[model samples]
Target: MATGIPRTKWQSAPHHIQPNGLNSGNTDVHLSYEGKKPELEILNTPPANLRQLWPSNAGHVTPNRLYYGDNLPILAALAQDGSVRGHVRVVYIDPPYATRSVFQSRNQTDAYMDLLEGAHYLEFLRERLILLRALLADDGSIYVHLDDNMVFLVKAVMDEVFGRANFRNWITRKKCNPKNYTRKTFGNVADYILFYTKTENYVWHRPVEPRTEARAAKEYQYVEPGTGRRYKKVPVHAPGVRNGETGKPWRGKNPPPGKHWQYPPRVLDEMDARGEIYWSPTGNPRRKIYFDQSQGVPVQDIWLEYRDAHNQNIEVSGYPTEKNPAMLQRIIEASSNPGDLVLDCFSGSGTTLNMASHTGRRWIGMDNSREAISATLRRFAKGLEPMGNFASKLESAEREEESEDTLSLFGPEETAKPSPAKTDRHHAITDFALIAQEPGADDLADAVGQWLEWKGESRIMQFREETVPYKTGKPQKLHRAKRRKQRR
Candidate 1:
């Protein structure tokens, strides 16, 4: 028998080593279970039949998209579509956490069920992730939001799907206030977001926050005597030894032992000449960083300021498990640029889509819950109330003392303080197409019909009615009831 290729030649094969020069050993380190299918099989899964809820008109701009269906099949269809195959820039998903509970809305209406557990849940997410990966652009990023219950397990699955090398940050966010729990464990007020990239090259805009007065005072303590500017001095040398000019002595001094100057001698001389360098009496040199020149402090992994709405003054869609809009704003700004497509498959109160629209990014949101759809539509039509400030009850009491006006929701008493105009509050995009998948599209149409009837003239009229045929080869028309007289 012919002798097999030499070991060196086999090891030198392209498949044996990754582009980054890391050895990709033959052994596959992946999670294996009874129901896990091959990646190829998952990719080949049948695509769903997407039916537009309304016909698009010429007046509409580049309309965003909203889907009402199971995300898996919808994602499968998107994966095969040439336009969306690899064009999505950002994806943020907050799927069910396998808590085995039925989540409801504020009115006790059933929203969704999270009954899958163990291997079944794993497979469920794995399949969707595989399709999402295919739909992601080469320079794209995805954030998977989850609670403590399934974060660790899902992290492993994410590592397997997105590759361990592509993993970015496990961002921990304080989702709520302190909880007084009877359980033996610590209070669970934090949730995690697993960030990942499609490839080594990805879009990233650094996020920063204005430093607090206390923090600014603590960090920029030194004040320049001449310019009265707040500045901080840092070491002029960096770690590591160099044999070039950076290691050479400048003037009468050299870099500290085993270290090198951060800049070349000529550059250091320029900085010193320009008054950007500080010199000590002992002949040590340091770089001066001015507080006025700084943009702000870099945002870190730990987040504490983005707690959920806990007060009645904060306006919300009344959708259970709704997230803070500011949190989604930060993520959208950091990971994507204007006009880039942002997707959220588990679009619960449509917070992601709303923020994306507000931030000038195109978005696509999908959810299977009928209640979620109704809530999202209503939020888009009726603007959210402005958040009221209650930093101190004394301040509020003082304001009340100054004015005899009383705030009331009914009668002439409402004249004291009217709600802010719709232009001042957050509202949904006027142009977006709604789509529902087949087999259940008819039912979704009926539900939407009822919602439109309930809303009457208040319903958004941007979308024109259309008769779309589903898989059953039957055309379903969205009906609107006659306007009901306003109640006294």
Candidate 2:
């Protein structure tokens, strides 16, 4: 069970029982029935005993932040904050996919535990999603990446949390090469990303891909003799009957009986005079579409180019389940603008953070594992020194050998104003602080207060108490209670 959340609210509906004769060994059956249902509940609940910290030497503060803890609490804390709430423009989370296996590193060191299965797994994700909804701006969007094991189930959960009407795309990404292991199923090579928006109106930067040589040659089959430029011919008349000017005659020829001119007759004449209309041997006039005028092909949902690192040399951080940076870059560029706030809660290797910074987007990354934090630190350290002209080289606090406790660094007073956007090739110093997780939010707050007393920057450090829990669960239909006859 997740802390600060009651089990009843997460599992309000009666558990559906699996039908007989189904193999109990198969986890797929768990999705069939006998589990908690999704529900939408009260949001705006605050996290208990939350603490905010900064580095004492930081000049200007950047909204980019990284938190070390279970994301539920971190997300709850952000949802309740006035400045951060409903301000995030884009969120991309690749959470544990309920694989029921403990992930380990190449040296056999434990990385993360994904043991929660069945209804427990569903409920756990549901609770956090509710908070995420409140945190998204009205025009913001979220992308949930999932492994094959849980994509279908999680899709249902997403539909319930974000209305089905707001659901965007079910993207299929080629995650790796074909697996050769002998198994009952086909070679697992692809995974899914469920995209959803807070509402019909959301931020969207149309993505374009360069047209391939073959496609370009095929589509632009015509070539202008004078300029030798590739072009295509399209019908100037469209499928519609109109009594307006578009239905009138052009060049002493009337539009086809069931069609209307795409442009006014005079406009068509002007295009013809400018050599923008192609006249076929039969005298049919078609509009000339040039290759140079196109905005490239719109990106599709089926992605095959970006995949996980194939070998150690190609690996960025060597963290387990690290995603491709190109993928993260695409998501950031397409869904968010420069200086927009981006979030990744299950920020395992910090791939999202790295891309977010490089792309000029402010970001917040949260992860609970020490190894994860260490990996993120290592990832940020590489090649950052060369970018010092635009970005300040990141500094990491040494981990104490004996205590092994979380450390909180107070940023400098210069960080109080919005940090300049790191748009140049050089890396500008992005305001960042690392916090150790305390037993309680109040404890963390007390630590912040104590540190502020010595540093004299209490105004910058803020904390919120987690008194009321933000309620969330997958949307599900509940059984109505039977009304009993009142005794006279």
Please give the CA lDDT of all the candidate structures: 0.74, 0.67
Candidate 2 Cα errors over 4 Å, as ranges: 1-48, 51-60, 180-184, 213-215, 237-266, 311-313, 383-430, 440-488
Top-TM-score candidate index: 1
Worst 10 residues of 2 by lDDT: 413-422
Tens-digit per-residue lDDT, 348-374, candidate 1: 878898888888898889999988887
User: Each candidate's TM vs. the true structure?
Assistant: 0.80, 0.69
Model 1 residue 188 CA deviation (Å) reads: 1.6
Task: Extract clashing residue pairs from model 1.
Answer: none
